[model samples]
Target: MSWDLSFMFDDLLPALLVGLQYTVLSTVLGYLIALLLGLLIAVVRRVRVVGPVAHGIMEFIRTTPLLIQLVFVFTLVPPTVTPLTVGVVVLGVHYAAYTAEVYRSGIEGVAKGQWEAARALSLPLRRTWGAIVLPQAIRKVIPALGNYLIAMFKDTPLLFAIGVTEMLMMAQRVGQPAGRVMEAYTLVGIMFLLVSIPSAILIRRLERRYAAV
Candidate 1:
């Protein structure tokens, strides 16, 4: 059967955009949560008093599949909390495990001499991290973090399993009446590529920019 490209663009696109808005919102909010929490996890994991416990927790999160975590939250949380909110939190906390590793690597990559120099100057621990180490470490991990952001965007579709009307769910909704599954699915694929490709290119550029520093 011939594809009706016009129907896909004119009818399907708008419906998908509604879902896309939620997808974008989840990605942004979730990535913000992941970025901050991951850094905190990495930092806390370095502390002598709590390092082992933090390490164990991080490993548990890292080992578990994110889909399971999302389902668990959706099942166990109070119904008062919306599925979208639960999705955002699960996505963020799930990705935080991976980002934590990125952060740990970046923090470790900082030259030992820099830490020594900070100590030599009698810098307070907070000042040393804030003024010296973290600035460099965060810069080094920006590209990796961007990659996770894109990954999180793709993962937003999985919210469908939890009854969220994200892009793919909307695509299915759009297709059902028309019996144009191909058109609907194809459009969804194109939309994902449109955003993810440029994002990946930008991340590569960031990688180069930071590497030069």
Candidate 2:
């Protein structure tokens, strides 16, 4: 079929932009969950006894396909939970496993002498972690976290599988009605690139800035 630039610009693009709102909302909310839960998971894994279980669960979460997790969470949750909520939550949790590792690596990057010095100064555990550890760790890993945000935004299209009408799904709906899905799908990809590329460049700049530090 012929490429329908007019239909793409007038119809598919508009529909995709509407869905873009859900896509952005899911990514932002999901990333917030990941940021908090991932830090908690990282801290929890420092305990020698509980660490193994957290490690095992993180391993399981990291290894599993996210689509499966989304489906499982949807099935397990109460009926009142909206699909958008499910997507936000599942996306957060799925990425949390990864972010946990990122946090761990950031923590490990702290100098051993810093830990020794904190002990020598008799710093309270909370103070040591809050003042000496997490700030440095989180700062070092901010770029990594930003990359994951971009990845999550890209993955928001997967929400379609779980009935969240994100950009790609909206495009599909716009196009399938007339059996001309090419323009719709094409615009979806273009929009993703438009967003993801600049974000990636900004992250790269941050990575360079951090590396210099």
Model 1 lDDT tens row, 15-87: 9999889999999999999999999999998899898898888788878888888898899999999999999
Ten-residue stretch with the least lDDT total in model 1: 57-66
Clashes of each: 0, 0
- Model 2 TM-score is 0.97
Error of 1 at 211 (Å): 1.5
Off by over 4 Å in 1: none
Which residues of candidate 2, in runs, are more than 4 Å off? none
Q: Write the per-residue lDDT of candidate 2 for residues 1-213, one digit (tens) a residue.
A: 689888888877889889999998999999999999999999999999999999999899999999999988999999999999999999999999999999999999999999999999999999999999999999999999999999899889889988999998898888999777888888888899999999999999999999954
Candidate lDDT values, in order: 0.92, 0.92
Q: What lDDT score goes with residue 57 in model 1?
A: 84
Residue-level lDDT for 28 in candidate 2: 97
